[model samples]
Target: MLRTLFSLVISAAVLAGAYVYTFGVPGSVAAYFGPQQAADSSAGAAPSGRGGGGQFGGRGGGRSTTVVLSPIEIQPYQDVLRAIGTATALRSTNVMAEVSGEVTAVNLEANQMVAAGDILIELEARNEALNLEIAEAELAYARETVARYEQLQTNGNSTVTGVALSEARLALSLAEAKAGLARVSLDNRTIRAPIAGRLGLSSMDVGDSLANGSLIVTIDNAEALIVEFELPERAIGILQPQQVVRAMTPTFVGRVFEGRVTSFDSRVDPVTRSVTVRARIENPDGLLWSGMTFSVELSQASAPLAMVASTAITWSQSGASIWIDNDGAALAVPVTILYRQDESVWLEVDLPEGTLVVTEGAQKLRDGAPITSADAPRGRNSAGDAAAPNARRDTAPRAGAPT
Candidate 1:
C-alpha cells in the first residue's frame, strides 16, 4: 500500500512539472504567442510582463503612451545558416595504359608532381623498332614502283592494264607501311599526364604489368578546388551565389579553408528534401585533396540593409505585429517582418511621425485599451536602451505594479 501511494505521488509530481513547462508557472508568467524586442537596442536592465491570450490594450492612467524609438541600424535577413564547404582540386584523372609490355622506364613516382605531356612510363620496344625499320623499307619500295608506273605511262611503252597493276601494288605497299608505323608507335607504351596536376599513390610498381586501359596513377589539378555540400531544402531559394563560406577538417582544426558558393542544385531531393551546393576556391599550396571530409558554414545574409529593427519589438500570431500608441489607446500595430533573429524581428513599417508604440504593458492591454504610462517601466521594452521621445513613457514604472 505504501509503495502504491509513493508511485502515485511521483506520477503526480511529474504531471505537475509537465503542466508548468506547457502552461505557465504560478508566479512568473511567460507566453510564446507574443512578446518581442528589437535586438539592436542596448540591453534593457529590466523587461517583465504577464502571460495571457489576445492582443493586450491597457486602459488606465497607470501607463501613458510614449513614442519609443528604436535606434536605427542595418541588419541582414540571413537565409538560416547553411552547410560548410571547402576548396578542392577541380579536375583529376587516373592514368591508364593503351598498350602492354615489360616496363622499361618509370619517369614519375608516388607523390611526384607532373605536367601535361610528361612521360611517366615506357614498355620494351625491340619488336616495335624492327617493325618500324621494315615499314620504312616498304615505303621506299612503294615509291619506286609508283615512279616506274608513271614513267612507263608517259613513254607509252606499257599497256594501260600493266600501269594499273603497278599502281595497285604501290597502294598495297603504302597501306602496309602505315599499319607497321602504327604498330611500332603503340609498342613504346609511354603514358603521359593528360593535365597539369599532382600525382597520387600509384598502384603500379616498376615491373607492374598493365593491360590497355589499366589505371597507372591518379593526377589531380591542384591549382583550384571545388567542394560540394548539402543544405535544407527551404534554404535553397534564399541562398545567394558567391556568399563567403568557411570549412575545416579534423586534421586541420583552427585553420579555416575559405571558399564561396559557385552554384546550387536547381531542385531539392524528393526523399531527403536537401539541396546540394558547389563552391570553388583556390587550393594554393596543394593543401586540399579529393574525397576529404570537411565541415562548412555558408553565410545566408544577402546584404545588410539600413533601418532594420530589433526583432524583439515584434510579436507573432497567424502573421506578425508590433505595438504603438494610437490616438488615446494602446494600438496593436501590425508590421511586416523583414527577418526573425532569435528573440528579435527585423521589421519595417510606414508610420507618421510622433506615432507612439507600446514597448511595455503589451500583454496586459489591447488595441483599444486606455493606457496609463505612470506604471510603465523605464527604458524601451525590447530589453534594450531605446529611448522614447516623451520622458513620461520612458520613465514609467515596471510590470507587476498597481494599475
Candidate 2:
C-alpha cells in the first residue's frame, strides 16, 4: 500500500508539470507558486483599456502584444469615370447649288480648304449672261434718252414736253430694275462656301446637269473637335462647364487628347439614367477626324477620407474592422471601405486623422488587450516608462500641426 501511494504521487507531479509547460499555469496557481510573475505583470494587469475599467485587461500573464502602428492619414480620393463618345467637327455644312443648270466649272478639290463666300462651283449661265447684257444695253439707251430730254427741258425747249420727259424717266427706272434682276439671276448660277472649312469630294464635273439645291460638297471646320458622351446621372453634382476631360481613340494608339467640358444636357435620360455631355478639344493638326469613336475619361474627385495600410484591416463575422491603438490597448474599430488602391485603403470610419492603427501583429490582439508598438522608440513600456523591453516611443508630430 505504501509503494502504491508513492507511485501515484509521482504520477500526479509529472502531469502537473506537463500541464504548466504546455498551457501555462493559471493566475491563482502562479501566485501560489511565486511572486515574480505577478510583480512583472502588475502594471499590465490593470482594468481593460477597452471597457474603461474592467477585469479583462490583458492576455498571457498581462503581457502586451507587439505590433506595428501606423498613423491614419486624410487623403483625397478620385474615381475614374470612363465612357465612349463620338467626335464631330466644330462646324460642318453641306454646300449645294442654288439654281438648276449644267456644271460649267468645279473650283474645289477633295479636302480643299476654302474661305467663306469663296466660289466653289459654277453652272452654265450663258442665257442668263445674255439677258444681263441686253438689260444693260437697254439701261444705257434709256439713260441717254433721259439725258437728252432733261437737257432740252433745262434749255426751256418746247420740243420736249413735260409728259414726254416723265415717260422717259419711267422707262429709265424700269430699265434699272431689269438690270438688277438680270444680275441676281446670273449670280444664282454660282455656288459659294457658306463657311470657311475644308471641303469633301464632289461628283459634279464641267458638263454634269445639277438641279436647284443639289448637294455639291461637304465642308467641315475641323480646327477644333467636339466630343459627345454620356455619364451616369449620379455625377450631376460634380459635372460642370470647363471641367477637364481626356479622350483616346483606338486609331491614335497611345495618344491622348485633352479637352474641357462644354455643356451638359438639361435632363437625364429616363431609360439609361445618364446625362449627355459635350467637350471641345483643339485639333490644329487635324489628326482627329469627325465621326470617330473616342474613349472619354474624367477624374471625379471625392471628399477627403481616412486612409490606412491595407494590411491593417481585419475581418470578423460581424464585418470589416481594424485594430487601433487606443492609448496602450487594442481597440477594434469597424470601418467601411470606400476605395482601395495598391497598398492603401480609404476608410469611411469616424476615427479622427492621425489615430494610430496596428498594421502588423493585429491578428493576435483582442479588444482591451495591451499593445506595444514596434515602431515606438526602444526602452519604454506601455506606460511610457523605461521598463518593458519591447515598448515603443512615438516621435511623430500631432496631426494638423505644421511639419
Candidate 3:
C-alpha cells in the first residue's frame, strides 16, 4: 500500500510539469485568458463601427487600416512606338573596273571626295595606239585606190567590174579601221567614278594587273542618310509618308536625329508579319555612317486621358484594378490600361475626377474596410510617405474611441 501511494505522487508531478509547459504557470495562464475573455465580451456588446469588422470577432468594431492615397487627374497623353533600325547611305555602290590592264597610275587617295566621271586609275596603252595608227594608214591607201579606180572607169580606161572590186576593197579596209579605233579606245584604260561621293580604300595599287569587273573602290553619298526599320503589319494603316520620326544611336549619345518617313514596302513579310519602313535623315556634316544601328521612336498625339501613378495599379484573378477611398472605406475599382509611361499609367475608368486612389498599403484592405490616409495626423502610417493633410478624411472608426 505504501508503494502504490508513492506511484500516485509521481504521476501527479508529471501532470503538473506538462500543464506548466503547455499553458505556462497557473497565474500566467489566468493573466493571459482573463483579458481576452473580457475584451471579447466588451466588443460583442459594442455597436457596429465603420471598419465593419473586429480584429478577431464578427463584422464591425475593427480599427481602420492606414493607406497612402493619390487624387485621380486627367493628363495629356501621346502614343509612341519604338523600334530598332539600320542606318544606310542614300546612295552607295562598289566601284569596279570596266576593262583589264596594268595599273600605271593611281589618281585617288583613300577617303577622297570625288565628282562624277573623275579619272581614278589609268592603264598602259602604247601598243593599242601603234595598232590604231597602222589601221588608219591601210584605210588611207584603200581610199586613194578606190578614187583612182572610179576616175579610170569614168575616163573609159578601167572596166566596171574593176571599179566595183576596188570599191569593195575600200569598204573592207574602212571596217578594219573602225574596229582598230574601238580597240584603241578600250586600251585607253581609265577608270572613272560613276557618281559623286566619298571614296573608300583603293583595291589595286600601281603596277597591279587587275582583271575586268574587279573591285576598284567603294563610294557613298552621305548628303542624306536612310534608316530602314520594320513595323508591325497592324501599323500599316497608321503609317504615312512624311511623318516625323526621331532616331538615336550609341555612337552619338544624347543627340537625337530627326527624320521623315520616306517609303514603305508594298508587301508585308509573311514570316515576321511586319512591313519594312524607310526614313530619310539629312547628314550635311557626315556624322552618321552606313550600317550603323539606331533606336527609332515614332509618336502620335492623342486626346487627354485619366492618369495615375503606376504603383496604384494592382492585378488579381479578375483583372487590373485600383483601390479608391469611398466615404472612408476601401473600394476596389477595375480599370482598363490604355498607355503607360515611365512613372505613370493612363487608364480608362468611370471614376469621378478628384477620387482618392490608394498608392500604398493596399494589401491590407478589403471591400468596405475602414481606412485612414497616411497623410492624416493621428493615423499616420509608417509604410507610406506623408502627403497633403487636406487630401485625407477621418471617416473610419478608431480603436478605443467613441462610435
Candidate 4:
C-alpha cells in the first residue's frame, strides 16, 4: 500500500513540471508556491509597472518577451535587366561586280580599309576601251562635217541645202549618245567601294572571271557597332531611346562596352512577346566586331524602400509584417516585400528610416505585447544605433535569462 502511494505522488510531480515548462507557471500559483524572491536582483532599478518575472507570470503586470532588435534602413531599389544580344557593324555590305568580265587587277588586300569611290578591283576592258575609241572617232567626224556644212551655208554655197545640214546635225546627236554609252560600259568594268569601310576576304585574282552581281568582297564600317537584343513586353514602358546600357563579350573577358538605346521594334513579337532593341556603341579601338555575341545589361532604379533583416519579418493570413518597438510594446506594422537579397529584404512601407524592429523572439509577440531586449544593456542594433524604450537598462543577470 505504501509503494502504490509513492508512485502516484511521483507521477503527479512529473506532470506538474511538464505543465510549468510548456505554458509557464500561473501567476498566483508561482507567487504562492514558488520562490518568494524577486526574479531580477536589480528589480528596484526597473521603471514602475515593469517586472522581471513576467515571462514566468509571477506577480507582474503582463508578460514581456525578450527579443533582439535591428534598425531598418532606407535603400534605393534598382532592377537590373540582362539579355543576350548580337553585334553587327553600323553599316555592312557584300561588294559585288556590276558587270561580267575577267578580273584584271585586285587593288585591295583582305581586311584593307577603303574610302568611298576607292577602286577595289579592275576587270578586263580591252574590248570596251576599243569601242569607246571608235565612238569618239565617229563623234569627231560627225562634228567636223556639221561645222563644215554650217560654214558653207553661212558662205552662201548652193550645195549646202537646209535639209542636208539638218541631217548632219542629227548624225552628230546620235554619235554623242553612242560615246556616252561606251564610257559608261568602260567605267562599269572597274569596281569601286560604294561606302567607306574595311574590306573582307576576296577570292578573286587577276585571272579570275567574275559574273555580274558576283560577290567580290565584304565591307563593314565598324567605327560604331550596333547590338541587337530582345526585351520582354513588361519592360516596354520603362525602356526609351537613349537609355544607358552596358554590354560584355565572352571573347574579351572583363571588358565592358557602354552604349545607348537607339531604337525599338514597332511591334512586339507575337510568338515571344518580346521587343527587339538596338544600341549603338562606339568602337574607337576596333576591339568589337560584327557577329560577336554580347551580354547586355540595363539598370532601372525605383523609389527608396525600407530594408530590414529577413529574420525580422513575420507572415500571417493577413499578410507580412514586422514587429516595431513602440515605447515598451510591440506594434505589428503591415508591409509589402519589394525585394529580397541574401539575408536582407526591402520592404515597401510607410515607416520612416531607422525604425527599431524585432529580429529575434518574434514568435512570442502579439500586437501591444510588452517586450525587452535580449542583447547587452548597451547593445547596438543592426543600423549601429540604440533603440528606445525596450532598450535594456540593467546589465545585471536575472534568473531564467536567455543565454
Candidate 5:
C-alpha cells in the first residue's frame, strides 16, 4: 500500500505540471482550486491594464519642464578692463621751515584751504632786524668817509693812492650793507605756501623751537585728484593720454568719478610685467582724498554684439552653453563669452537674431526635451490653450501620460 501511495503522489506531481503547461498558472490554478484563490493569486501578480506602468512609467516618459525665455538681440557693448588703484592729490608737498627759529606764530589751521604765497607760519626775526640796522649805520659812516676822502684828494691834502684806497673801502662797506639788507629779507620769519592747496595738521605750534628743514605742515591740491594703477604691459598699445576712465570707491558707492589718463610709466616693471597708469579726476566737492583706494575701469570703443542676461548662461562639463527654445523644445547651444557687464553678457554664438533663449529653469532641460514657456498664460502650454478632455483621454494610451 505504501508503494502504491508513493507512485500516486509522483503521478499527481506530473499531472500538475502538465496542466500548468497546457493552461498557464492562473487558469490551471482556477481549474484545480476555487475561483476565490485564483483571484487572490491574480491580485498578487504584476498590475495589468491602466495601472501597469507604475510611478513615472518605463523609459521615454518625462513631463516637459517650464522655463522663461528672452530673445537674443544685438546691443552696443563696451569692452572694459578693470584694475585696482589709489587716489592721490594732484600736487602734494611737505611744508618745511626754510630757516630755523622759535615758532612765534602759527598762521594755518588744520584742513585750511590756502592760496599760493599765503603765510603758513612765522618765526622771531628781531636779531635779523638789529643786524640790518647795524649794517645800515656802517654804510652811512662809509659814505661820509668816502666824501671826506674825495674832498682831501680834490684839495691835494691826501695822496691819490690814499683817496683811491678810501673809495675802495667805502664800496666794500656799501656792498656789506646791501648784503645785510638781503639777509634781513631772507630772515623775514614768514613761511608762505608754495602752492594753492588744503593744509594738513600743523607739526609745530607757537613757542615750538624749529630747526631748518623741519616739517611745518602738509598741503595737497585735492581739487584735481589722480588715480594711479597698474595694467599689463600689453595694454600699452591701446593706452593713450586723455583716454576716458571711470573710478569708484567704497566711500562713494554708485557714484562714478570720471577721469582721463594723464600719464603712464616710461618703462614696464620687470618683476610685475605691468605699467603704471595715472588718471586725473576732478574733485570739485573735495569728496575724494589722497591715499584712498579705488576701483578703476577703462573701456574701449563700443561695438555691436549679441547680448543676453548673465543668468541665461550655464556651464557644464562641456564648457559654457545656453538653452535655445526651438519650437517648444530645448536646444543647448555652445557659446563663447566675449564680455560681461553688471547684468548683461556679450556672447559669440551661431544663433540667429531674435532666437529665444531660456533664462530661468534651464537646469531642468535636456537636448530635444519638450519645454513649456513659464511666461505663458496660466493653465496653458507653449502651443496654446489647455488640452480638451477628449485629447487628454487620447493621450492616456501613451506611456507616462497621467490617467
Candidate 6:
C-alpha cells in the first residue's frame, strides 16, 4: 500500500510540471508582462504588506499606495527689488575767463583744491600802468585850462564863442582822461577764483591767449559731493524735499554715505517717464570728486510687512503679485507693496484669508497649470512642491509647518 501511494504522488507532480511548462504562467501571464498589473499589485499591498490597501500609503513598513496627483501648492515668499543707479559730484562748475588777457602765470595747478578769490592766473599789465599815468597828466592840464578860461570870461575880454571853445576843449580833455583810466583797468589782468572748489585740468598754458568768455578750466565744489538721478514721474506722490537716502559707491566700498533729496525736476521725461532728482552728500575730506560715477537705490515710501514675492510675478507693470490656485490650478496675482525691509520686499494683496500662491516657476506655468502635492514648504513657494492631490485647502499646511 505504501509503494502504491508513492508512485501515485510522483505521477501527479510530473503532470503538474508539464502543465506549467506548456502554458508559461498559469493565471499570471499578464501580471508577468504588464507594468500596470505590477503596479496595481504593489498599490493593493499595504506599505509593509502589514494590512490591506488604505486611503493613505503608510511610511517605512506600510505597503505601496495609489495616489491621484493634481497640482502643486506653493507658499508666498518675499521679493527682493533690484535697480542700477548713477553717481555725480555734490558741486560742479564750468569756469570761464573773466577778463581778456594773455595767460602769464597759472598759480593753481589742475586738480588742486583752492579757496574763494584765490589768484588762479595772471596777465601782463605794464602798458596799462603807463596809460593810467598819461591820463592823470591830461586831467591836470584840462583843469588848468578851464581855470584860465573862467578868468578871461570874468574880465569881459574873451568873446562868447572863445569862452565856449575853451570850455569844449576842457571837456574833451577830461573825457580823454576818463578813457585812459578805463584802459588802465583793462590791464589789471589777474584772474581770481570765483568759488572754492577743485580745479580741473586747464586748457590754457602760460602763453595761451584767452578772450573774455573763453573757457579757462572747470572747478567743482568738492567740499561736498552731489548726485543727481532720475525718478519716475509716478513718484510725484511719495518723495519729499530733504528726504534721507543711502547708497554704496565705488570710492567708498561697504561704506554708506548719508544724503538727502535736494530737488526734483518740474516735468517728467515723456519717453522714460522719469524725472530728475538730486541728492547731496557731505565730503569734508574732499575724497568725493566731481564727475564720479556711482550706483544708488531708493524708495518712495517704505514700511514693514510679513511677506513678499518676485516683481516679475506682479505681471501688470508694478506692485505685488499672487498665485491664485483657482479650481485646483496655479495663477499669478498682483498686489501693492506695504513696505520694503532690507533686500526682501513686503506686500498686502488682500487674499481670501487662506489661499496658496505659486511663488516659484512662475515662468514655467500659465493661469491654470496642473500641480501635484508631494512634500511642500509652508508659507513659501519653490520648485518641487507637492503635486499629488491629497489634502484640502481648508486643511492646508500652516506657516513653519511641513507641507
Q: Highest lDDT: give the candidate number.
A: 2
Off-target runs (Cα >4 Å) in candidate 2 are 1-24, 35-55, 58-61, 66-68, 157-170, 302-304, 309-322, 332-354, 359-365, 372-403
Superposed Cα deviation of residue 72, candidate 3 (Å): 2.1
RMSD of 5: 11.8
For all predicted structures, in order, the TM-scores are 0.64, 0.74, 0.64, 0.82, 0.59, 0.52
- Residue-wise C-alpha lDDT for candidate 5, range 34-119, written one tens digit per residue: 45444444333332211111112321132345678899989878667789999889999998777888888888788889999998
User: Higher-lDDT candidate among 2 and 5?
Assistant: 2
List the candidates ranked by lDDT, beginning with the highest: 2, 4, 3, 5, 1, 6
What TM-score quantifies how close candidate 2 is to the native fold?
0.74
Best by TM-score: 4
Instruction: Give one digit per residue, the lDDT tens place, for model 1 in 162-266.
Output: 758667676867767686776658644667788988888875657767787777888888777788888887776667888777777777779888777789888
Positional deviation of 23 in candidate 4, in angstroms? Answer: 5.8
Give the Cα-based TM-score of candidate 4 against the true structure: 0.82
Instruction: Indicate the residue-level lDDT of 68 in model 1.
Output: 34
lDDT of 5 at 2: 100
Go through the candidates in order and give each one's C-alpha lDDT.
0.61, 0.81, 0.76, 0.80, 0.75, 0.57
Cα lDDT tens digits, model 6, 279-381, are 7888788777666765656654333333534422445456446655554444567676555545445556555443555454344444444432223343211
Instruction: Report clash pairs, candidate 2.
Output: 376-393, 377-393
* Candidate 5 Cα outliers beyond 4 Å, as residue runs: 1-70, 138-188, 232-238, 308-337, 340-352, 355-403
lDDT of 4: 0.80
- Candidate 4 lDDT over 1-403, as tens digits, reads 9999999999999997665444444546545542423222122223313222334333224435568888889987777888999999999999877799888888879878899899989889999999999999999999999999999999999998999999999999999999999999999999999998888987889999899888889999999999999998877877988999999999999999899999999999999999999999999878788899999998888788899999998999999999988766678899999888789899989998878899987877766656666663533322233432222244554458886
| Cα lDDT for residue 388, candidate 4 | 27
RMSD (Å) of each candidate, 1 decimal: 12.9, 9.6, 10.1, 6.1, 11.8, 13.9
